[model samples]
Target: MTRYWVRAFLSGLALSAATAMLTVTASADKLFGAMEKAYVTNPTLNAARAGQRATDELVPQALSGWRPTISVFGEVSRTRSSKEGVPIITPDGPDVDSVAINNATSGNVSIQLSQPLFRGFGTVNQTKSAEARVDAGKQNLLATEQQVLFDVVQAYMDVYAGRQYVVLRRQDVSALEAQVKAARDRFAVGEITRTDVAQAQARLAESQSFLVNAQTDLARAVASYVQMVGQEPGKLSYPKVVSIPNSLKMALDVAGEINPQLLAQAFVEVARNSDISVAFSNLLPSADLVASAAGSDPDFAQSKDRSSAVQVGAQLTIPLYEAGAVYSQVRQAKQLASQSRIQVIEVARAVRQAVASSWNAYVGLAQIIKNTRTQVSAAQLALNGVQQEYQAGTRTTLDVLDAQRDLVQAQVLQVTAERNRVVSGYQLLAAIGHLTAVEVGLKVPIYDPDANYKRVRNKWIGTDVKTVE
Candidate 1:
């Protein structure tokens, strides 16, 4: 009967294991699916894209310098004299005490257009500077996307790792409960002391406590996953490690070429160089073609006495001096350009260091994962031997318990190493500037910054209206 019962117990355990594996397989959600959702729905990423669109307007604002500015004016006024009536001269004669000349109502309408002929090449450089800034904004948007995606990857790993920990903890609790029951049965049958049963009970209690702590950690991980990916985590599919750069040197090279932050700073340096050109241009002369037409009525209610005039001329402005502010600005711009150049170098070095560190971490985690898996396997074998020895009365119950504890620890370490491996790969990808939706091959619409820029850059009308949302 005992042999049959033992066979039934082993069969039940095997069935439970099979069921758990099937459940995990059936309920799995791919990591890329979560990443795609985050890329599309993360508010931070969307806001960064919107901010880049806003920065796109700078190009059009600078382009406005090449376009003519038109303005219209109309005014009505009552003119009155406080002094006594004085003599006023008409076209034909002079009149004394002329109240008509002292008081009158007048109105005028005028339209003027001014086109910038030249601004010492300042307009050209300003537009170029704006273009550089727009490029920088694009890089910044890319950096934000990388950052959000990295966060999503981290959260996903956290939830998965936490779930694994919970599973191990539950296994520990179940194993200890069985041990406690076995110890109790042995003591009642005069096979073991009450002290053995007490030890088993103590271990079971500790395992239960650990299980509760693991549950708490899993809850926190779920919350973080929801916050990052915009939804609750389901059963996670097997993690996929991203392909890495061939070598550390290649990784550093890639980062220098495409790391979004470094690229953004590079564009910033370019814009600052253009700024210096704009500042120097301020010292040179500017020319504008100005034209105006006006109509005036002396008395709207009286005679048809109206006059019209038209004027067209070119105006040149020479900046002789302005309290040394222009020269000061030029000097400041040069200093700023120098600073930006220094920052570019600094950022490059920083990128290299980040890539190196991330590469080392990824390599270390890979090794740790391999070692931890081996450790789990060895520990499981040892625990099985210890259990067999305890059944044969050749090993103490405490020895079996210690072996079980070691196995649990090894399993936890294996899970943690696996989590770290995936997360480190993501870190490496981000350090090399490939952690973007497009780079990751996510099936989502890419936001184009130039679309809004093109929509508003050549917009000549609606000066007071906004054309892009």
Candidate 2:
């Protein structure tokens, strides 16, 4: 009998090891690989890049003011005329019963070129404004990249924690099932009362319900993971904690320098200031160099009645008055500039706030993780002790059930705390502007937002647009 029992124990142990191996194989996906995939495939990040490319066109549009415009025009026409006169006695021979008709066809073509000499410095100011806006757009793109990556991190962690919770709940359900059976066996042997058996059965039902809820939550988390990463989640490995500044003040200082949102707002303020100059420029004089060449035939009946000419001159226009429209535009621009300045301040404050909050949360989660780990260990010990005491008749079935429940809760708390710690660490990195793909060393090509700008900014003629791969 002893040899038979030993063989059975070894067989069960081998089966458990095989199951663990299978679980490990199924979850071999690593966090960084998932992030790299999302960085390449996320729609939100790609859309932001497209939007930035569109913004780059503004530079060339503004530069057009400094270039000459050429145009050609042509015209063709036919003319017919008839005259009738009363009969006259002498004079010319044809005057006796004079009637005359004439027909003529003529064509002409002309070309003109105009180059802006000066536009009250509007071109310069507008170009400056457009360039600033493009810079701001690049920063916005960076912010979008960070946001998408952070979202991926968040979803990955959620699914990771959700999977753990489901496993714990399943284990809890299995433990209670065994406890319920043992309780029934004891009651049948008159070693325990019906009440104890009922309590054990009730706990088992509750654990089963918890297991179902945990499973549902895991499904939702997987759906979210798919949405963020643009694919189904594999078994996710735990993400490594990202580095952050050592002190809150240091974090704030770092954020002030590199935070994408804050820098974008600052660029907006610069653009707004340039806009004020552009609007004020409208009230100043503008000059253009205009040149044209033309040829015309006045009448087909007289082939010699042709003329050609070339003209060159400078044209100047001073805005004396525009019914107060230009003045109102100038005022509007000034107000907008003022608003942008305030927005910069607002964004700076918000960035600092985010940095502080993320730092605090990260620190707090670390403590929670430590405490929950301790609680899990203690609860496990207490459950083992209660189970042994119940077998010895020194503890009740209720005690054992309560101890089991405590252990499960502590284990769940530990998972949650650890998950939150990872997430908060990422959040802190994002707040300090360090959560970008390149900063994280993702093994993918870094997207240079300026590449599109450089390609399009100086292009004088092209209907074709180059898209980034």
Candidate 3:
């Protein structure tokens, strides 16, 4: 009896060791590797960065108002006409006669320059609006980066958890197969009924079905992993749960301060207010300095008859009325600005709700993890007792099967709970705006949205558009 107890203890220990081996906790490096790959290679992230670069172009467009525009234009044309009572004097005297001229060629060339001195502060406000929008774009890009990183975390956890589930189901099936063999042996010796054998077989079949489903889930997870991480998933280790704020209030505070969506919306309000200024600017006068130098030739011949002139002057235009267009635009801009302010409030409320929800999920998963672990331990102990009692003819085969089923269910719960706990932590981190490549310290080159912005922000003359990778 003592030997039997010792053997059971060793068997339980071995089973625990095997289960622990199956639970592959992915290293920090592996988690970071997936995030880094997604950061540099994910098409969604790359597209967002490209969009931010496009937003940078607005700055240069706004600055164009402060710069001089220079242009050169030329025209050559032929004239044909009949002249009446016209006389041409050639080194002698003038005569009056009926003259005809045909196909007279003339050419003119001019270079003009204009520099805007003022546009009723329209250019100033426009530049301010564009700058604000660029800031918003950067924040939006950061938000996208967080989303992509969160997705990668989820995919990694799913694949890892799915594979572990398949392993657990396989173990359950194998155990049930052994139980069926034992039941058959007992029946052959007139110790048990055929119904006992059938029960074990039924449970085995159910376990096999579960294993198949787990495999399918794993395959789907792999496909998603490939899409998000831009490559095939390898043996992923289970991720450690991310650390988050201790309470809901702390989480909300962090989110309000750093959440990219909220920040982006605030910048949008600034941009809209600048737009209102730009619209009202139309009611004021604009001033510009215009200069031009030109040469005109009456004939195609190179002679002293060519006339050239240079002119420079300032121009001021005061708008009297625009059919109510300017007034309507100003009103529209004010309304939109008001709407943007309201949107900022809406966004803040939404972010607060999100942070609260994420905090609840994180805390809930922690409790679930604890309860599932306890359930696994208790179920394992109960299954061991039931198996021993059945061997001693003190428990029915059905009771033994029930205990085993309970153990299997507990194991599945534990595995799923662990996965959910990690995912919830990652989500909480994202909700607080910390799920970024740089925040996670991924081992890859961080994309700089400002690099491309600075490159093309003041470009004077170029068609090649620079974009962030």
lDDT of each: 0.88, 0.89, 0.88
Question: Distance from true position, residue 4, model 1, in Å?
Answer: 66
Clash counts per candidate, in order, are 0, 0, 3
Instruction: Give a tens-digit lDDT track for model 1, residues 1-469.
Output: 9999999987975675556445544467788988998988888888887788779889888988899999999999987765546677988788776655357798999999999999989989999999999999999999999999999888898888888899999999999999999999999999999999999999999999999999998888877767667666777976778899889989998898899999999999999999998998989999999999999998776667989999999999999988899899999999999999999999888888889988999999888989998999999999999999999999988998999999999999999888888888888999899998888899988777677778877776665533333
List of clashing residue pairs for candidate 1: none
Model 1 compared with the native: what TM-score?
A: 0.84
Question: Model 1, poorest ten-residue lDDT window?
Answer: 460-469
Model 2's TM-score against the true structure: 0.87
User: Which portions of model 1 miss their true places by more than 4 Å?
Assistant: 1-27, 78-104, 183-202, 463-469
Clashes of 2: 0
Give the clashing residue pairs of candidate 3, or none: 25-238, 26-237, 26-238
Which 10-residue span in candidate 3 carries the lowest summed lDDT? 20-29
Best of the two (2, 3) by TM-score: 2
Task: Please tell me which predicted candidate would have the highest TM-score against the true structure.
Answer: 2
Each model's TM-score? 0.84, 0.87, 0.85
**Runs in model 2 lying further than 4 Å from the true structure:** 1-27, 79-103, 189-194, 299-302
